[model samples]
Target: MEIREIFAHNLRALRKTKGLSQEELAHEAGLDRTYISSLERQIYGASIDVVDRIAKGLAVEAADLLRCPEAEATK
Candidate 1:
């Protein structure tokens, strides 16, 4: 899958795992809720700064948001 898809998938999964709604995550990340929704839907690409902000919101490493789910399944 493409990197955008990977990021979207991981972002959604991590957000759910943390029991956070899109709005909640967006608030924590200091972003708009629609922007967070767009990212989760793969409608927009996140910049390095946005990724860092999101990672901080999720309390995870930025790399975690970019990890390929298929690769993880093989591990």
Candidate 2:
């Protein structure tokens, strides 16, 4: 999958795992709810700064958001 797809999938999974709604994650990330929805829906690509902000919001490493799902399955 593409990087954008990986990031989107990871973001959604992580957000759900943390019991956060899109609005909540957006708040935690200091971003707008629509922007968060756009990211999750793959309507926009996240820059490095945004990735860092999201990682911080999720309390995870930025790399975690970029990991390929198939690769993660083996670990």
Candidate 3:
């Protein structure tokens, strides 16, 4: 899968795991709700700085967000 898609999947999974809604995650990440929604839908590509902000909001390492379990296992 594409990196953006992987990131979107991971972001949604993590956000749900943390029991946070898109609005709540956006608020915590200092981003707009629609932007967060777009990111989760793989409609937006985030910069490294934005990735860091998202990781901080999810309370996870930036690397964790980029790690795709299935892909990583193959590598």
Candidate 4:
């Protein structure tokens, strides 16, 4: 998979593990629910600023949001 796809898949996995819905995660990430859904579906590449926001909202380090073969979020 592409780096973006890995990141998106990992993001969705993390959110589910936290027992949060797309709406809840988006709210926490200061984003729109559709946006999160789109991201998880790998419809777009998230910017660094948005990734930072998502990391903070998820209470995780920014590095934790990156995917492997890149930064190391996804396996």
- State every prediction's TM-score relative to the real structure: 0.97, 0.95, 0.91, 0.84
Whose TM-score is higher: candidate 2's or candidate 4's? 2
User: Among all windows of ten consecutive residues in candidate 1, which has the lowest summed lDDT?
Assistant: 36-45
Instruction: Give the residue spans of candidate 3 off by over 4 A.
Output: 72-75
User: What is the C-alpha lDDT profile of model 2 across 6-62, one tens digit per residue?
Assistant: 999999999999999999999999999999889989998899999999999999999
Our model 1 lands, by Cα RMSD against the true structure, at 0.5
Global lDDT scores for all candidate models: 0.95, 0.94, 0.92, 0.82
Residue 45 shift from truth in candidate 4, angstroms: 0.7
After TM-score superposition, the amount by which residue 36's alpha carbon in candidate 3 deviates from its true location, in angstroms, is 0.5
Best by lDDT, which number?
Answer: 1
Q: Which digits, one per residue and each the tens of the lDDT, describe model 1 over residues 1-75?
A: 999999999999999999999999999999999999999889988999999999999999999999899999999
All models, RMSD in angstroms = 0.5, 0.8, 1.7, 3.0
lDDT of 3 by residue, 1-75 (tens): 889989998999999999999999999999999999999888878998999999999999999999886877799
User: What is the alpha-carbon lDDT for the whole of candidate 2?
Assistant: 0.94
Q: Taking the tens digit of each residue's C-alpha lDDT, what string does model 4 give over 1-75?
A: 687877797788778878889898889988999999899988989998988988877888777767554454354
How many steric overlaps are in each model, in order?
Answer: 0, 0, 0, 0
Residue 48 lDDT (model 3): 85
